[model samples]
Structure formats: structure tokens, C-alpha cells
Target: MSVVARTVGLVTANLLAPAPGGRLDLEGATRAGAGVPLQIGFDEIGVPLSEVTFVVVDLETTGGSPTQCEITEIGAVKVRGGEVLGEFQTLVDPGGPVPPMITVLTGITDAMLVGAPRIGEVLPAFLEFAGFGPTTVLVAHNARFDVGFLRAAASRLEMPWPSPAVVDTVALARRTVTRDEAPNNKLGTLAALFGATTSPDHRALHDARATVDVLHGLLGRLAPLGATHLEDLATLGDPVPHKRRRKATLADSLPTGPGVYQFLGPGGEVLYVGKAVNLRRRVRSYFTAAEKRKRIGEMVDLTQEVRPIPCATELEAAVRELRLIAELDPPYNRRSRKPHRRPWIRLTDEPFPRLSIVRSVPAGRSAEAIGPFSSRAAAQSALEALEEAFTVRRCSQRLPVVPSAEARACALAEMGRCGAPCTGAQSLEDYAEVAASVRAGLTSAAGPVVAALRARIGTLAGQQRYEEAAAERDRLRAYLVAARRTQRLRPLWRSPQLVAARRTEDGGWEVVLVRYGRLAGTSTVPRGVNPMPTIDALVATGEEVPAPSTVLGASGTEEAELIADWIEHPATRLVQHEEGDEPLAWPVDGAAKYPLPPTA
Candidate 1:
């Protein structure tokens, strides 16, 4: 058995060794030395298959169902570098008579198991022998059965089950071996086909040994197809179309750094845009079996090139990806695709200045806008809340400064819902006061809005109108959410220039420069180095932004919000600016005084 193991080890070593130029070839086996070391200098995507300790496990059970059945015997062969490391075999007393059928199949009768250790004892020994964690790969012919029985036994014994990475030889055989080579992926059939020295005969140890050979055979077949790492084993049978797999070369040139990657079609059209902490790894994964998205597979089919735009930090990569997705409108990239479509609640440019839902706030009137609400419906709900609080006109019609008698009141005015400013019932001076209140509610002072909504909710609740009260509560909640967002974001957007820094994992400094709430530049200072010079250089070379024309600043509202979130992150430290510049601070009491209405 020892000599046979050495021969199998030699065969496996030759089978898995990379050919000259770091490619595996079935016909190039003669070029490999007897004990060739595993290839070096490859990026560590996952544990190398040659270095992984695999425990080929098999179990004899009293019944088919793990929940109802008891494990009779356990057998596992631990192997690494194609050599047998150790073996674990033990019989477990089920504490019940084995059924005639199970006894006949496994040949483990009650007489043979009289003094065998019970599952509580056997399970601990098996776990200790199998080892734990990433270095260990658990292999079984049909892993579900063996692993299920083990986990059940552990549960029954109240033992901790270390769930290790598993490889099912049945699945692997189906992936690597063809129907012509083997009629079906069964233990007996595969053992014969792979020429295993031990033949499975309904016993645990014999079947586990046969499975070790089957596992090696399957890996030998998968090696030529580029499934050499432990991570590759998980997606062994992935039906990644050849066209998409071939295009993986596009990622070969990308750097392993934080960046935005654009998948370009044949005509140079951007197919998709994405951000990743490691450009090379992320883009390369699209071609591997692990990338199972049908849409992404289709995108890869169309992708003739992958273009990388490396950034200094992850935040920069995220911002650039957002901007590119919005700019290119890549068909395959979802989310953040339409920055222009984000809805905003704006006071229309008119004498009445009714609340309106607009896509983009007109250049100079962003202060009159309260939101880049998540959706048009949310903006509408907030508008209703503002209208409920303040008697500003709900009409969409633009009215002149001095209304003609022909301009009759709308139905809202007739119901006394509006102040009837259009019909001249309310004087211009009085209407100005109403507009001022609405503006204050949207921006600086939301206390009045919250108080009014709260009072309305109380009155409705007093009438036992719970449903209406709930509706008002939702409206107020929406208003408060939008108001709070605006209050936090407005200050950041209004700042002429702001600098912030955060400590990196390596004690380095990740510094960013913001101009009007848009990320202008970023730099990293190495560990144990002076960050001041780098920060000063970053500020001096930062993109020059003009005075913001809108409350959203020079960028889209989403971009401004992204910047605000970064600035407010707990790790971020604001660098104080020279005197006379407005301090980078949100109003302490802004909208904080306006508590949201309780759910009814």
C-alpha cells in the first residue's frame, strides 16, 4: 500500500505540474521533474490546490436520511501534495440494532459494533483529525451524504462542527470527465475508470480510498482547463461559455489597485462600468466560473476590452465609477445610471412659487430645492407635507405678480385650503409671509413645519381617524427625512474648499480635497512620513471649482451626498482652513429639533 501510494503521488505530481511558460498541458508531462515544486509568483487569489490538505471522507450509515439515521462507520484519507498524510477510520455504535438491509449492505452487524465507541466519542476524534479552516478541503464522492451524517452526529453529541470547504467528486467528475470516458458519476464506476488500487465494496475505508483517486483524476482533468486554485474547485462545473472565458485576457493588463473599470464593446462603446479595490482581480473574476450572472456573461460576450482608471483611494474609485456610469450610461451597468433622473422638490420660479417635482434644479435656484429625493413619489409626498403645513398654493399654474380679476381661485382656494392669493383675497404682502414660512421650513427652520404637522396628527387622532393620522404621520416622516438630508448636505456644498483625512490600516494617511462638496483630489501619505506636505500638495493641485450655482454645488446631488457621507464618516478628521473661510460645519440644531412623527 505504501509503494502504491508513492506511485500515485508521482503520477499526480507530474499531472498537475505547470508546463514551461506557466501553462498546464496534458501532453507535456515528460518535461516535469519527479518532485517539481508548485509554481511561484502567482497572485494569491486562493489557496493553491497542491498546498491544500484534502480529507477524502466516506461514511456507512444505518439509514438514508441524516436526521433519522445514525452513522455506523467513518473513514477519511488525508492527503496533500498528492501524498497520503494520514488516515482516520472508526466504527460508531449506533445504540440500536442495525436494520437487516443496512447490515447486509455495509456488512457491519451488531456483533462487530458491540464495543465500538459511540458518536459522541467518534465525532470529536474525526473533527480533530480532519482539521479546520481554509487549509483543509473536505472531499467526498457525494459530499452531501457524508457531510450531512457528520453534521447530524455532531449536533446530536452537542459538539461544534467546523464547516470546512467541501469538494464533491461526483460534481467534479461530471464537470471534467465525459460520458464516453465514464457512463455515470458513481463511486464504483468512477473508481474503475480512474484505475484506483482499492475497489469500493460497500465499506467506508475502501470507498474513501477509491474517492481519493477519483478526486485526483478529476483535478488532473480540470488542471488543463485552468481550475488550479481552491476557489476554482467551488465552481468546477460552471458552464461559462467559451466566448466569455476567452475574453478574460482583457483583464490581464489591469493593475491590482483601487479603480474604475469599463468594459468596452467592439465599437469602443462602454458596455459596463464598475469599481473595485483590486482592478485586476475584480475584472478577471468576470471571466471565471465564479461570475454566474447571466447578464454579466452577456456583457463579457460583448466586451472586447477592459479599460481601467486607477484611483488613489477606494472613495475616489467609487466616485469615478458613479460619474462614469452616469456619463456613459453603460447598458450593462445598473444602479446610479441616471443621475439626471433623480427627482428634486423645488419651489417653482414664479410669483406663487408652488412646490414642484423637477428632475434637475434650475442652475441658480438650488437653495429653493429641498431634495434629490430617492423617487418622484417621495418628492410628491414631501410636497404634500409642506403644503399641509403651510398654505402655499398647490396649483401648478404660473401666476403674475399682480393677478387679474380673470384669474379665478382654484378648487383648493374655494375649500379654504389655500389663502386665495391668486384671486387677490390675500394681499401680496401677506402671501410673501406665507412663502417665507415655506422657504424657512424647507431650509433653516423646520420646527414650524414639524409642530404644525404634529398638531394636525393630534387632532386627527383625537377624532379616532387612525388611518388619516397614519397618512399624516408618513407625510411628516418623509418631510423630516428630506429636510434632515438637505440640512446636512447644504453646508458641505456651500463650503468653498474643505480638506479631510483618515488613518489607513498601515498608519498612513488617506487625505481628500473637496471643492463645493465634490471630491477634487486625493492622496495617500506613507506610514511614518509627514502627511502635511502631501496634504498641502493635494490641496494646491486639487481641481478648481467655481462658486456653486445650486445647493447641490458644482456636482449632482448624489455626488454631493456621497462626499457628505465621506466627510461625516467616523474615521474622517476635518482639517481646519485659514481664517475668514466659513468653517466646515453643519448647523448643530439644523432640523435636529424637528423630531419625526410617530407611526400610528
Candidate 2:
């Protein structure tokens, strides 16, 4: 009937026995037992559970479903370090008759809520009492029931729900408390098993209080397994397999900063590589149920350790991830692993030059190339378009200093597809001029080749040659995109050392240093950190990669292209540079006429 009477009755029944003076001392026994083998939960190297504020909540409704029923009462206890900080409790009119079964179960009668406030009146005060902080953890026994109702109420009331980290005591108990300790993971049973000071009586506040005790008890059980942080508690509620849980320790030492991470498999092979704004969080996510990809799950199952490489900014992390994936060629990476293998559209350097598809950039050749196309088919398509527009020589043999009169011209020359310089049908100077026009078209956007191809497509379409028109259109689109990309990359490729910066989300700056279009170094200036010193330090430490003796290789060509794309991003502004910066001269007319290839 009363709290003290219940306590005395428990003592009389020997559940809580009297101490030395023959007077009941529940506080003494609690204090004595609370210190006994306190299982420390997850290692709190980043943010400990003790530092997190929790709002343990419970709700009583007219029925089980939030949509069908209505919340009759709400209760919450704000706690940190097992000490109560604040509380919120309210009764609300359900706007209808209280069901007899519900009233019988919760003892809440419509008469008692006659003039009580409704949900709209109660939710604001409850949210205010819960407070607002990123560190806040919302706790509830069978959390979905409470949180779901609250969310529904917020939605119906047009109120904003600040989604805080949620911990379900029911899920926690299932993971932490053995069945032997509690027959069923129910609030009343768990409360009784854990020696909760207050027993659950189906009233919201009383149930919430009992759930709070259960939460502490379950957390104590979890400490032995090193599940102590607020994030740890939030993550464990899911049905993550035990083996995966064990691998979570791999992320324990990872720094909480922007970086790239690799999951290493047996024999130290890199299984996967990824970049993240927070190294620790991202690595931890791989071990959690949040990672639902079956391939990633298998990779995680075989992972032996997590390797983190800290970066100065998200941009640095991204570039490093791309470069590492290219270098290591991890089997799990789906893209950017083997850049050298991608096809390139090369303009052969010869008296009668022609467009050709090549694997490597021809190590010593000085010919202009416009690719790194994903496949030879794509490069071939672009070459066909260039040939159709320029009619340059297409024979793939070394021509003699003086052409022989007996040398036969190919059918392409008779069909007017090629200039037939092989047989001297076209003069060497004339063929050279055509090749030069093709080179200019391959290296710049909206050049003669593009203009010719576009005009040809228009003429074909105007004549109702729909199929031919579409084919020409596709070819023109591909050539223009490749050419524009090459134009954008030329400046970076020619510069000996290029430094640039963009403002970061945290009111900071991200500085990127490039050499020959490849990422050489990157650093950041945090919001309040004096940017000049950080910039100077970054420049000092950066490897001033000299102007590469040879052309930019295909090994990191995709990375170079990626950097160019970032530099061209509408949001990015060049903040600093070793050499003067020039605006990327993209065609205002080309993209409108033809669709360009999407950047990687």
C-alpha cells in the first residue's frame, strides 16, 4: 500500500534482512552490494556511458497500438550515473471513454482524467524536461512501444522529434541478462529480479522507475563484456551475431576523426577499404547490424583487424580511400581499383595521325590522349565519332618517307570515311592538318570535331534519319564529355605544384595539394584554429612533387580526374595556389546540345 510498508514487509519476509542493529537498512545493503564486482561496461575511451544523460520512459495507453489507441499517461526519469536528475509525468484525456479492459489493467479511469491536459499540452513539457543534447540517450523497457507512441504523437501534433540515441531495456536484458537470472524479460520480473527499490504497479512513473533499475542491472551485466558506452548500448539492442560483436573490439583504438579504414582479412590481405568523417564510428558500423550488404557481412566475418589512416579533412579521406583502393586492389572494392587497366582514347603521333584505343598511354609517346574510358568499346565509340567528323588517316602502319605509287588505298578512303594518306591520295600536309584538328577536338571542348559531328547529327535528324541521328548524337556526346574532362584536367596536369582550399562544414578550411594532377597532400583548419599556421604547416610538410618527367601515368589517372572534378565543383572555390588558378573553360553551348558523361 505504501513504499515504507512494502519495504518493511519485504524485510519481514527476509528478502531484505536487518543488519547489526536489528533495524532494516535497505540503503546499507544496497550500498554494500552496488560495489560488489561492478562489471565495467564497454570501454569508454571516446564517450563513456556515465557521462550520457538518459531519459528512461514508460507510457500507459488505452490500447496497444498508437494509431488505434491513445496515450492515457506518460512518465519519464532523467538520470545520469544511476542518480535521478529530473522527471516528467502527466495524465491526459484520451478524448473518449477509457476502455473497461484498459482501466482494469492500468487503473486509469476517465473520471480521473476529466479536466486533464491532452497530448498536445503534455508533449511540449515532456520534451522540455527531457532536454536537448547530442549525448542524451532515451531509455525504455520495450522501447518501441514507448518511442513509437511518442513519435506518432509528435507527428500528429506537428511537433519536431529530436531523435536521440535510444536504448531498449528489453533488448538489453535479452543480450546481457541470462534466462537463469530472470525467467522472462518483463519489466515487473526484471524489476523484482534486480531488487528494484520501487515495484512496477502498471502506473507509468512506477514502471519507468522500475525500468531504470533494470537498465542499471543489465548495464552491470554488460560491463563484463566491455559494452559500456552510450553508443555500445544503442548498438547492442539489434540482433547482431555474437561473433560479429566480438570483432567490434577491432574498432576500440580507432581515432575519432576523419580518415580511411581498411578491414584486413587472414594472412593480412586487405578485404575492404572505405572513408569516413569519423574513423571510429565508421569502423564500428561494419561490425554492427547496420551493415546489411551480404558481401560486407562476409568480409567482416573474416576480418582480423581494422586499420585506420587519419586524415585532415573529409576530402583527404576520400582521395586517400580512392588511392589506397587503386594501390591495394582490394577484392571488396567495386570501383577505382585498377586505374591503369581502363581504356584510353589516344591520338597517335605520326605524319598521318589517327585516333586509336590503347591500354596504357604509350610510355614514351607525346601524342594527346583523351581517355581513361571504362572500356575499350566506349573509347572505340568516341574514336569512330572523331574519324567520322575529321576523316583523318585510319591505317595502323608506319608510313614511308615517300609514299609508293603501288600502295593501295583502303575502302574507307573510297567510301570517304578516311583521307587515304597511306597511298598519298591526300598530301602529308593536308593529312597533318586534319590530324591537328582532331587533336584540338580531343583536347578541348566544342572544337571543330565536335562542331562537325553536331552539325552532321542535326542534318541527319532534319532529314528524318532518326536511327542515324541518334547514333551520331551518342558519339558526339561521348567525345564532348571526354574532351571537356581532358581540358579541365590539363591545367592541373601541367602545374608543378598546385594548392587549393575549400571551406568545410564546421566553419573550417580544407587544403588540398596536388602535383601533376595527383593528390600529394591534404590538411584542415578547424573552426577556431588559426588557418594561416595550419596552412603553412601543411605546405611545409607536403611533398612538393616535381613536375613529373613523363606524362601523368594511367596508374592514378582516375584520381587525377576525380581531383579535377572536385576543383570544378560549383561549391568549390580555389582559396590558395602555388601557381595562379584559371577558371575551367567549359562549353556553354555543348552540354545544352549533347549530354555529357557523368563524372566518377
Candidate 3:
């Protein structure tokens, strides 16, 4: 039919219509990727019904929340160039308990999907079979629900959708039909009106077929003239496709001590090396976010790999981080030019409180200070450990004093923490000497208690006390990790400052959280705005922390405010780290895996 003729026929029929117009009936919404609203058969925009290719998809979901919900049944049909492609029908394994309502709607029980490979298996096979590829287009009654599933699936698998273009047939039906024609334009009524003799089975494939027929009839009566290409067709309702992604699994990175970590990629490339107080947990989150995921997945798919070198302390981790970067030359390490130093505790006032890595001497000396650890997180952890084990005071030296009669020294002095410069227990000169000794302890052997424990370990081993020796070893490891945690405090954001924490697919990054910028408490993001890691090599270890400093480069001042609001929300929780969790073992150099022959 010519375009002019179709228009004339539509208008003429409108004028001579007995009632108002054909009642446009619509079925369920799209259950896959980025689904749109349920568009009526006759779209609000008046797409004229005749100009576009259409497909109908019916899905029976195990439940809602596409991630948890699996489709029990999927029925789809394509109509383009006025012909239906092969009917798409399949029963998917939900891999979990199926809901009663879903079974009732679909008539597909758990027994049917039980032995089925699971939605993961079914989705890939079905899409491949359904001609979802570069050139394929799709249409559904309601696009949103259907599209959401597709998105979730794709992300879970770490692959981009094969096809993005799709149309909602329900929209066209609504635009062409009048509401007065029927109380509602559900599938059954529309099928009867279109002269399609099929009975409504509520089965996926059956409904899809009925939709195709009705759409075919509409096309026959409405195909626009000279519509030579797919793009030429006017979109009735916007096409909604499924968007897929994996969930994040971070948390457990920030710590009180210092340590080192490696950012690995496919084929074992060292993406970067970093140091943190909490090493194990900080490494896992890189892979979980959306942005980092694509790269990690791609790298893993091409070359699967992972690698991590442990350290005893944050100071050690900082030093090790620089060494690894120098040796590994990971392509992703851009800010490696700066040298790392364990922060030095410097006194601030005349009595000088400990200063660490005094990045710069504050002009004349407003404060005492120490180092510039490879990262601030590491430095803080180290300081904390020292304070705990050495019994050094961590509070600022400039404490408030009571009246002379009341200034009998705080309880800290009584508890041996005050160093007693107040009540003539020690002279200022003598206190300085003691403080100097405390600072010197950083390089000295641990105090008498540690020495005594070491001697015990040696004595137990000499007496063949293997069990005692082993216990001592475990204790030492714990102490090392604890010490590391206390000394380092700057490499990571304060917990809950990171966003979506998850491991990457390729196992390159254990977890990757993003912070759009400083104002956004890092943890509030839950899922940061960075690219997520890939699927194949998954090793999600830690939660993602935002790059608070990155706030500088963003466009507007409001960006900071926007981020601040998100962080302050009562729902935000700090990311926590667990000990001994490790990144997966992987190769440094790219290597190929080959199928093995039969064993000899």
C-alpha cells in the first residue's frame, strides 16, 4: 500500500466509523533491558501503526527484581517486511524456588525448569537463537519490565547486548484504536477484533503468536509506502531493550594499619600497585562497579589472570607498592612519579606532638610532624599501631589545663599515658628526652613485653614445643597485620565513603567503588560512577571508595553539594574490611590456555 493511500484510508475510516475506533489492546510489559512504560496499541504519538516492524514478547517471571527473578517462560515472534521470523519459545530454569503465582500464570511448574540449565544458560542460548544481534530489532507490549531483565542478565554475564533497537507493539495498537471500543484492550479482545482465531492460552509462545497476527493485520492495513529501511519507520513508543549487570561485593578495605595491594588484569597484567592499611579488602571492589567492569571483563576474556604480594605493615606496603610499580610498569599506573616515604612523627608545638610525613614544614612550625607515607591511609594505620603497642599518647599535645589548684595532671598521667610533665613528675626537659626515646622506638626492637614473647617462642621451639611455636607464629602474624592497620590511615576513604563495592568479572580488581567526588561520602554511592570490571575472572574482595580528591575536576559547585546530600542520608553505612581475604592467584605475563589431551 502507498503511504498516501494508507493515510486516506485511515482518515476515511475514522470519519465513517460506527463506534469511535478499534480498541487498542496491550499485553504485559517488556521484561528485559531498559524497559519503557506499557505503551498502548494505539500509541499516544500516533505512529500510524503501518510503518514499523514489530515483535511481541511474553515472559513469565519467577518473581520481581530482575536480578533475583528468572523468567519461567519466554515467547516471542518477529514481524518485519510483513513476515514472522521463527517463533521464539523457551522454558528457562529459574535456579531457585518458583513462585506460585508465576506458575499459575505460566502453567510451567518447577519440575519443567528444574533440570533446565538455569536462566544463565537459557538467556544466552535463547538470544542467540532469537536472532538478537547487530541487525535484529525487537518489539514488546510493555518494554520496561522486559528490558530490565535483559539488562540485568547482560551485566551479570559481562557482555554488551547484541541488539539495542526494539519497538513496543502495544503503543501502536493504542494509537490506532479508540478507548470506547472496549473497556480495555487486553490481548484477548484485540485478537478477536483483528480476526485472529487463536484462543488465549496465557502461554508465552501462544500469546506471542497472537500478538504477531494482530500486528501483521495492522501492518497489512497500515504499511507506509516507500519505507525502504528500518530507520525510516517512525517509533511509536520508544524501544526498550534489556540492560544487564552484576552486583557489587566490596566492603573491607579501609583499616587502622598499612599494607600493599596490586590491581591485576587479564593475563595477569599489573594494572597498578597500591598500599593500604587494610590490604585484603581494599583490592576486591574494583571489579564490581559498572565502568571498571567493561575493561576488566574484556581483559579477562582475552587473558584470564590475578596476582597479589602481601606485606607485614602499611609502611612496608607503601614501599612495596612503589617497587612493584617500578618493576611491573603496569599501564594503568599513571601517578607513580611521586616517591613514597613512611611518615615521620614530628612534634608540632614547642613540646611537639608527633607529626608524620610532614609533607611540608608549616612555614615556622605550627605543629610537630613526621612522614609522607606512600599514601595517607598507610601512614594513619602505622600511627595507630604504634600508639597501641607502644602506649604512646595519640592526642594533641596542646591539651587544656585546669586552674593551678585543679591542675594535678589528668588520669592519663596516672595511667602512665600522660608522661607526667604536669605535676613535677618530670621536667619539660626530661619529658622531651622521653618523647624522643618514644619516637626512636619506631626503629628499635619492640619493648620488653614483645622481647619476652619472642624469647618464649624461641624457648618453646627449643623444647620441641611445636604446637606452642605454631601458636606464636599465628599471634605474630596477627600482630603484624594489626600493627600495619594502626600505622596507616590515609590510603582509603573513611568507611561508607565508597560506593558500590564489588569484584570485577575477570578477577582483576577484587572490588571497585567509585566516588564522583569528595562531597559524596564514598560509601553512599553503593555503586560508583566508574566502569565496572568484567565477569570471567571474578575475585571481588573489597568495597569501592570514592576518589574524594577528584571533586576538583568536576564542572559545577553543586556537584559537591549533590554528593554531600547522598552521603548524609541515614541509610549510608561504612564499608568494613575482613582480615586474610586475598586476591586470586594470576599470571603476570599473558599466557594462553590450551585444551589438554588424554592423560597418558
Candidate 4:
């Protein structure tokens, strides 16, 4: 045998050969120091790397398949901040004969494991030594193999598996060390490249020790890529090298709070806008090897600097992001850049009021609009449905409030589809009553107008007029959605100011302070803390927003839309104030006439 092979074989035998206490002393010979392990699945964005714990592990099995093969040996080194805290090593009888080829490769024969414990006996002890906590991460040369075996064993034994975050050193090396530095990404090859304290010779403990070294080496490389937290390492997959990473320093100044961020190109031209709960972590993520989008990489390359604007809440950040995207018209933004361009169905303020589709709500107009529809077709469909229920005027004439006698009723009047108010056939009082019914239907889906439309649709469907029924259904859906949107916003429009709170995932409360229809401020009522004080503070800090009438016309600003969305959230509950400060009234029985179909 070669000198190197002989030396490695002697070392492996010495370590594997049980001690007087029937435990391996390999850890005592190699472990640097005892480390303090952190909790499992630890996820904090700015947590220092020194506080993170990694359980580097390796396993030797009979074959590749976990079910078909059996694990012969398991080894792991518990590490925290570069210190070796503990070790787990064991040999297991496969409950079957060892393959000759495997024995030759790993030098672990059936005779060596004859009196050893089975996997069922060894796994529990290994898991206990390795621990399962939030801050703990499992590392392996090729993690999939080791993790798969453990998972299979857990399933077979029906043991509750604590699935800690796993990191694959092979993947880490492929991104950290170039092929020129370490030709093939095998465990031994990387071990030698990183100058691991122990050489891997197929024995589990030695291989695991070597893997720990490689992990530390790769972590050093990850520092320049902005991976400084425990959670960062879990997502640090193979990244296509980004040229913009050189400008990664630009994101260093971003705050670790909820906010909107802008990527600016040369001459300070905005290239892209994005929102994140943690500005620093999100902007830093682009510099890491994990960002895979080619477009994002290209944008990052063009980006010369990053600008972060902190907000009071994630919802505020989302609204600010939309506003910034619209204001800058950044080339990278693909949506919500034109919140004002949505269609609205307006009721013209003439003697014979008629529905008119408009992109913007005309200022100083006496017309009331119900919209912000996705398209004109949807608005027109809703108008047609309203006409079916209320036969008002459809003409485009500047008639007197007392109906002009010179007006001519079009084909609609002859077909009994219109009240013929244009020719004075329909009196002003009667027409006003029809207009009131249309307004009620437009504001609430449960109103009489929608009920009439629903009944009409059902009658058509029963008669096998399938196309007519479908058309009516489409009209009803459009009207319902517009009404729902208006219903959510109308409360803010009616109330000068509204304070509300929604339960958060962390059992806290998210308080939103709004003026008119805009979000003025927001704050968090942390768990076990008094929410009233926080809510009061948030209200005191609210910015003065334009009155709802002037600010949110037909289609409101993005911020208004955002606040409306918040008010409609099912978990949101309004805090009781004086009776005089009551917010906009909603349908007490609920808008139940036309139930929305399941989304496609």
C-alpha cells in the first residue's frame, strides 16, 4: 500500500477501534474546543456569525438508496463560531451482511460491527449529541445523502424528526472554490484544498472532521458575498456570478427595517424599486450567489447605488413602493406603476344620468363614479347590468334637471329598455328614484338592483338561454367587485380618521392610523404589551393627508387603495371610540346577494 494510504488506514483503525469505555476517542484527539450550541432553525437577519452553530455530519451506508441500503456508520462534529463543541460517532450493524466492495472502500467489515448497536439504537444518541434547535444547522460534504438516510430512518421507526436547516458543503465549495483551485468537488479534494486538520479516508468521523474545516473555509469566502447570518447560509445556493456584486458595498448603508429600496443607475436614474421587511437583508441578498434571476443580475450590474426609505409597517412599505415605482416609472418595475389609469364607471350629473367609462375622475363634476375597473369592458358590463335593473337615460345630452321636452328618445326607449326621460316621458321624480336605486346597488351588492339581476340570470338559465345567463353572470360579477371595492373605501371617505388593528403572526397587533383614505402612520403593539398606548402614539404621529373627497376620487391613489385593503382585512378590528366618531357603515348582514365564484 502507498505510504499515505497506510498512514490514513492506521489512523482510522486507531480511532475506530473502541476505547476502554466502548466510546471512540477520535473527538478528543481532534476537537478544537467545546462550543455553545444555539437553538435550531435560528433566523435573525443581522445575527453575528460568531453566535451561529453548525453540526457538521457524514454517514457511511451500504449503497446509495436509503431504503435498499443500511447505514453502517454515522459521525458528526458540533461547532459554534469555529469552536468544536461536541462529537457524535458510532458504528452500526446493518442487520445484514456487509458488501465486500463497501468493506474494501470504507475498511468497515461486518465483523467490526458484529457486537455494535443497530441504527435504531445509535440514531437517538447521535441526535441527542447533535441537538435540535433554532440556531443549529446541519452541514455535510454532500448533505442530501446523509439527510436522506436520517429521514428514511425516522420514517421507518416513526420517530418525530426535528428537521434542522441543512447546508451542503459540496454546493458551497462549487460556489466558493473554483474548479482551477480544486479541480473536482470531492470530499478529499476539498479537504486537501482547505487544509483540513484531518484527512478523509471514508471513515465517518474523519470525513466529518474534514467537512467541518471545509465549511469554515467556505464561510470565510461567503463574508465578501454579504452572508453574515445563520439563515443566510441555508439559502446560499449555487449562484451565477454577478458582475454587480462588486458594487455590493452600495447596500451596506440600508436599514434593517421594513422599507422601500431603489436601485439607481448612472446619473442617479432609478433602475428598479422593491419593498422588503428587512431592507438591509433584502438588498444584501442580491449580492450573494443565491440571486438567480438574470434580469436582476443585469439590473444589479447597472445599479451604481441603493437608497432605502424606511416605513412604519410592511403595508406602508408596500404602498410607498407602489408610489415610488409610479413616480419614477422605473424600467425594472413590472406592475402597479399606473394606479390612476384604471377604468371607472361614473354616473353623469345631468338631468338624465347615464354611466360613462372614464380613466380619471373629472374634477368639479357633479357625477358620482364607481370604478377603478381592470378594463373598460368590465365597466361597460356593469353599466349594462345596472340598466337592466333600472331603466334610466343613456343619452349624452346636457338636459335640464326638469327633463327637456325637445329631447328625442333613442332606440332604447322604443325597445322599453329606457324610461325615455330624454323626451320627458319619464318624470324627474320617477327618474330620481330609479337613479337612487342604481346608486344603492352600485354601493352594495346586496341591494335590490343586484337581487333583480341575479333573479334575471337564474330565470334565463332555467330557460336554457345559456349565453344570456352567462352574460348576466359576468355583469353581476363585475358590479359585485366594484361595489366591494367602493364598500371598503367608502368608510374611509366618510370618516375623517379611522384607527384599526389586525392580529399579527407573532401574536402581536399591527395598528394602522389613517386620515381620509391614506395611511398616515402605523405601529406594532408587541405581545404582552399594552396596545392602547401604542395605538394612541401611532394616532398622534399620523401625518395630515388630503381630505378623502379631494384625494381619492373614482380610482384612489395607491396609498388609499392600500389603506382600503387594510380596512377590509378579515382579522382587522376597529377600536371603540365615542359614538360620534363612528366609522363608515358596512352591510351588517353582509353583501350576500351575489356570492363571488371561486377565483380561477
Q: Quick one: best lDDT, which candidate?
A: 1
lDDT of 3 by residue, 1-600 (tens): 000000111111110101101112233334244444322222121122333334467777877687777677777765544455455667766667778887777677878775656566666755665565333446555555676676687778786665445555555566455777645567787777776646557787778777666665544432332111222123222221111111111112223234665554554666666666544334322332212445444432332223445553333354456656666776656644533223334445545244343443331231123333445564554454344434344555453232234446667777876565545565666666655654443322234324434565688899999787655544443333322221222122222334423323333222223232222211111234333332111124333333233212121222332333333445433333321111111112101111111211
| Of 1 and 3, the candidate ranking higher by TM-score | 1
Q: What is the C-alpha lDDT of each candidate?
A: 0.75, 0.70, 0.44, 0.69
TM-score, candidate 1, is 0.78
- Please write out the lDDT profile of model 4 over residues 1-600, one tens digit for every residue: 000111111111111111001001110111112222222121234444565566788899999887799999888887765567777788888899889999999999888887888888888877887776655667787766787788788778788777665677887776678878988989999889878889999999899989888877777786566445444454555443535444555666778789999998988999999999888777866765546788888888888889889987899898788778778899888876676777877777666677778776653331256767778898998888777787767776666766555667789889988888767788888888887766666555446656678889889999999788888888878877776665556556545667889988889998887765666778887888889988877777778665433314322555666777787789999873222122466654324445774332
Candidate 1 residue-wise lDDT, 1-600, digit = tens = 010111133324322442111111111111112323222112445344666777788999999987898988888888887888777788888889999999889899999888888888788778887776556767887776787788777767777666666677887787778889888989999999989989998788889989988888888886656555544555445677656554655665678789999988999999999998888777767776768788988888888888899999998998998888788888987786665577878787766778888877654665577877788777888888899888899876787777887888888887877988887898878888888888888777887777878898899999999888888888888888888887777666777788899999999999989877788899999999999999889988999988765556677767777787787899999884422123455455457666666654
Clash count, candidate 2:
6
lDDT computed for candidate 3: 0.44
- lDDT by residue for model 2 (1-600), tens: 110101111111111111000011111111111322112122322445666677788899999887778998888888775567766777888899999998999999989888888888888888888885655667888876787788778878988877655677777777767878878988999999989878999899889888888877777776545354444444564566777766777887888888999999989999999998777766776665556788888899999988899987776788888988877989988985666677778777666676778776643342367766766777777888888777877778878757888999889888998777777788888877777776666654355666677788789989999788888777777777666655556556666566677778778877787766777778777887777777677768887665554444322666777787678677666656544233335445433345563332
- TM-score of each candidate structure, all chains considered together: 0.78, 0.78, 0.31, 0.80
Q: Give the range of the ten consecutive residues with the poorest summed lDDT in model 2.
A: 13-22
Best by TM-score: 4
**Residue 448 local lDDT, model 2:** 62
How far off is residue 341 in model 4, in Å?
5.1
Q: Count the backbone clashes (under 3 Å) in each candidate.
A: 0, 6, 151, 9
Task: Give the least accurate 10-residue stretch of model 1, judged by summed lDDT.
Answer: 20-29
Instruction: List ranges where model 2 is wrong by over 4 Å.
Output: 1-48, 64-69, 95-97, 148-158, 163-166, 171-185, 219-240, 264-272, 323-337, 362-367, 447-477, 504-508, 525-541, 553-555, 569-594, 597-600
